[model samples]
Target: MSIAEERIDRLHTLAKQAVAAREFDRSREYVRLARRIAERNRCGLPREFKRFSCPRCDVYLRPGVNARVRTQDGHVVVTCDCGELKRYPYQS
Candidate 1:
């Protein structure tokens, strides 16, 4: 894989572990890093996408465009612009 891809993969993995361990703060940081990598690599996501929503509508504040941030601790929930914050289970 390309360097960007590799970085993204690593970041995702770390985030996942952190989430599973309940390290929300760490997971958030990793997610933010992953999002930066995705943005730098021009992931080709839809323009109107804007952000990602949690599957459960508990928390809707992700660091990337429609990104699923995760770690070993658990998942960081996100609120959807749809008016409800949701919780989504994800893997880093």
Candidate 2:
């Protein structure tokens, strides 16, 4: 069967127990399943996840253990080997 159909079937079965007992853990599992199904169907996320951005350059921010920054104007000036800060937009 199709991924969406499979997810819908599982969701239907899980819905009863998930709602009846207010089982958040089980409900979360269902949510994950839904996400997987959406991905499989190329349907995309219901909502995007929030991401941090760079203040000085108005660029996308990516933090790493080895990355260093200089502090200025209450914000860190990020310098990368590529000479440009990578921007990561919200994706769900």
Candidate 3:
């Protein structure tokens, strides 16, 4: 992987750790930095990274903590505390 991709992966790990430690603001900063790096390098964020982060508030979502997860029809719904909702299709 490229240097930017590596850095984004590291940032993703750090953001998850920050959220687990309850340092939500730090996690948000990490997410924001990762996104900026991706934008500058003209690359897209990883699918796992994108799924675990709130696009509207840049917060790292922890299901049952800052995010609610539900399955509706053929898709999974993730609702962030900031009221942002994301849906991803599932095989079921």
Going through the candidates in order, what is the number of backbone clashes in each?
Answer: 36, 1, 0
- Pairs that collide in candidate 2 are 60-87
Ranking by lDDT: 3, 1, 2
Number of colliding residue pairs in model 1: 36
lDDT of 1 at 13: 68
- Residue-level lDDT tens digits of model 2 in 1-92: 66576665556456435635656456446655655676678754322111222223222223452124555544545554346543333323
What is the Cα-based TM-score of model 2?
Answer: 0.35
- Candidate 1 lands at a TM-score of 0.49
Model 3 whole-model lDDT (C-alpha atoms): 0.97
Give per-residue CA lDDT, model 3, range 59-84, as digits (tens): 99999889999999999999999999
Per-residue lDDT of 88 in model 2? 36
- In model 1, the worst 10-residue window by lDDT is 45-54
Best by lDDT: 3
Model 2 alpha-carbon miss at residue 7, Å:
2.5
Query: What ranges in model 3 sit over 4 Å off?
Result: none
